[model samples]
Target: MFQGMPLAGAQAGGGIVSLIVPLVLMVAIFYFLMIRPQNKKQKQRNAMLNQLKKGDKIVTIGGLHGTIAEITDDVVVLRVNDVTKLTFDRNAISSAVSRETAVE
Candidate 1:
């Protein structure tokens, strides 16, 4: 038996709580700093996907630029050139061209 030792139950419970508080704080920090922004971006991306329409000029994730010729539930037909049409997933479109691009 060790003399001058702290009570077993109290010491063990306090030590566990001390360890858990930092872990909980870390999870909260990660949620705010990392997870929250990622979810926001995903929501924006989903909104963009839902708003796809014909005649919308868009840039794909692959950097291809084209105007939407047709839109399906999950596929987009892009008219890249007079004879160069391409099909891509709705998610593959990164963003629509702004009004600045339409003027030119």
Candidate 2:
């Protein structure tokens, strides 16, 4: 008849719910604050790579700047200068430098 049990402490089963609620909130906060933006950025980068074409000036992940001379399935030929053309993997190409940014 509830004579030997204490029902108003950490053993009453309410502590688990309180602990889990904060943990779930922290996870949601982390996903929104950190994971979401990174995923969006990656999607934008992938879209840029898929839309690449010849004469588009770009900079590689390794800091090499050039114009796209040719694009194959997995390779990109960059016209670094008049006489220098370098071959690199498609994934190595980083963000595309806007045409306006290169003119100034």
Task: Compute each candidate's TM-score over C-alphas.
Answer: 0.87, 0.85
CA lDDT, candidate 2, residue 63: 96
| Candidate 1 local lDDT, residue 33 | 100
Model 2: per-residue Cα lDDT over 13-75, one tens digit each: 888888999999999999999999999999999999999999999999999999999998899
Worst 10 residues of 2 by lDDT: 5-14
Model 1 Cα lDDT, one tens digit per residue, 17-57:
99999999999999999999999999998988898789899
Q: How many backbone clashes does candidate 1 have?
A: 0
The TM-score that candidate 2 achieves is 0.85
The TM-score between candidate 1 and the true structure equals: 0.87
